[model samples]
Target: MAIVKVDNLSVQFAAKGGIKTAVAGASFALEQGETFSLIGASGCGKSTILRVLAGLQRDWKGDVELMGNRITAGKRFQGALRREVQMVFQDPYASLHPNHTIWRTLAEPLKIHGESEIEARVAEALEQVGLPSEAAKRYPHQLSGGQRQRVAIARALLLRPKILLLDEPTSALDMSVQAEILNLLNRLKQLHGMTYLLVSHDADVIAHMSDRAAFMANGVIERSFDRAALVNGEHRMAHA
Candidate 1:
């Protein structure tokens, strides 16, 4: 069964002139352990779709399913749904709490879920993302761009989620750092047997990370590319 399925999904926002349809009848599915991506220009509703699936945007229309369970609009994720899906945003600086220490930030989630061995888990999470255990005592601002993103990734994985919603996760970093984070993400995804739904504007990143990709314009998916097409740089032409 597909890990995620969205059929005829639509999202609208109130605007001065009228209702702005940010996502219009978009549809897609992700298989287990697949890295499926959505690539497009800015304002094409790529991130909006991620928000809906992440349960951050509840007012949407369509049929959606995750891990074989149907999701209802306007409802917060519950039970396994809350624990099984996670998201990593484009900017680590914005996503992390500057006032919180890394240990506090990483330990809070485990505590909320009533998990034991909080200290060990937090340290293990840091190690999993290639960060030293001592880094946990530092704040978000103390870390470099790549380190911050690694923290974000560690936090997302702490829940042991089955699917990760990646919203342009590497676009905010330097070119060299971007490659490192992407490689790390790929490695973690493979090691954990998790599925990914990534959104990015870079064709090269898509080519490197995705098994399949969809191109969007004006809030609609215009086309799709398979692994072969991506490897052959076919999507680059259309993206260009």
Candidate 2:
């Protein structure tokens, strides 16, 4: 069954000039345990869609559904909904709190959700993301770029979410680190039987990670690609 559904989704921002539409009637769906990606150039509204799913951008117009629940604007995500969907942001450094230690970063969500054994849970999350437990004691500034990103991934996983909204998850990392993070994400997804909605501008990243992908432009999803099309590199283009 489709775990994510979006129909006639649109988002607008009040720019200096006037009303600027970021996503205009964009729509797509993701099946359970599938990785669906959005590929496009910068400022094409791909990330906007992910923000909507992540509950970061709520002042939007359209229909959004996750795990069979219809989401409307201004609705705060709490309880099971919050636990079931998590987001890993694009910039690891910017996303993480500078002053917060890695342990606190990963432990906060578990604590908020009333999860037990905070210590063990934090250690396991770090290990699952290929980070040493000691790394948790350090702050974001004390760790390398790659390590910070790994912590971010671990934080997103602590909830055992069914859907992960990844917004340019590895864009800020080096090429080698990007590969590692992508592999880690794939492994975790398989291990947890989770679905993914990813937004990235790199065609190779989309082709490598996606079971299917949608090519968006301006503010609308222009077309979609299946595994076969992705393998054939049909989605590679100037805008992609």
Candidate 3:
């Protein structure tokens, strides 16, 4: 079953002199427990699509349905819907609070949702992300790049979200750290039976994590193909 359905989506931004179209007439769907990726060059609207799905980008025209519920445009998700979907951004350093400890970072979401067992959930999330419980005592600056990203992932998973929107999740990390994070993501997906929508410019990363991928350019999806084709370099973008 399709967990995410986006149809005829379009997003425009007010630039210096006029409107800039970021995503135009974009359409796609992600099946439950499947990994779908969007790959393209910089400024090609891949990240914009992810932002829209995460409800961080407003002022757009489109129809977006998550688990059969329509998501109204230009509005932030709230309550149950917000808890159903979570996002892991590209920059772990920028996404996390420098002043807050990892424990506080993970605890805030649980508090917002009025969930009990916040302490246990936070500890479990850290373990699931392969971080020691003591790591939670440190601030973002005290951790390595990979460790920080793990904390970020742990924060997202604390809510038990069914859908994860990853915007270039490992782009800011070193190659070895990227592999570790990718392995963690794969293991977590299998463990939780979660669905993933990933945005990345790295074809190797896409091949490693996605079942299917779409190539986007100039605000529109130009092509899509199976992961195997992408892995073997058999697929080519129309704009390439």
- Write candidate 2's Cα lDDT for 82-179 as tens digits: 88999999999998999999988888888888989999999999999999999988999999899999999999999899999999999898999999
Worst 10 residues of 2 by lDDT: 231-240
| lDDT at position 198, candidate 2 | 91
| Candidate 1 Cα errors over 4 Å, as ranges | none
TM-scores of the candidates are 0.99, 0.97, 0.96
How big is the positional error of residue 220 in model 2, measured in Å on the Cα after superposition?
0.5
Native-to-model Cα distance after best TM-score fit, residue 235 in candidate 3, in Å: 4.0
Cα lDDT for residue 79, candidate 1: 97
Model 2 clash number: 0
Among the numbered candidates, top TM-score falls to 1
Candidate 2 wrongly placed segments (more than 4 Å):
238-240
| Residue range with the least summed lDDT across 10 consecutive positions in model 1 | 231-240
Q: Ten consecutive residues with minimal summed lDDT in candidate 3?
A: 231-240
- Residue 123, candidate 2: Cα error in Å is 0.4
- Higher-ranked by TM-score: 1 or 3: 1
The full ranking of all candidates by lDDT, starting with the best, is: 1, 2, 3
Collision pairs in model 3: none
Off by over 4 Å in 3: 236-240
Error of 3 at 68 (Å): 0.7
Cα RMSDs of all predictions?
Answer: 0.7, 1.1, 1.4
Candidate 3, 159-190: lDDT as tens digits: 88899999989999999999999999999999
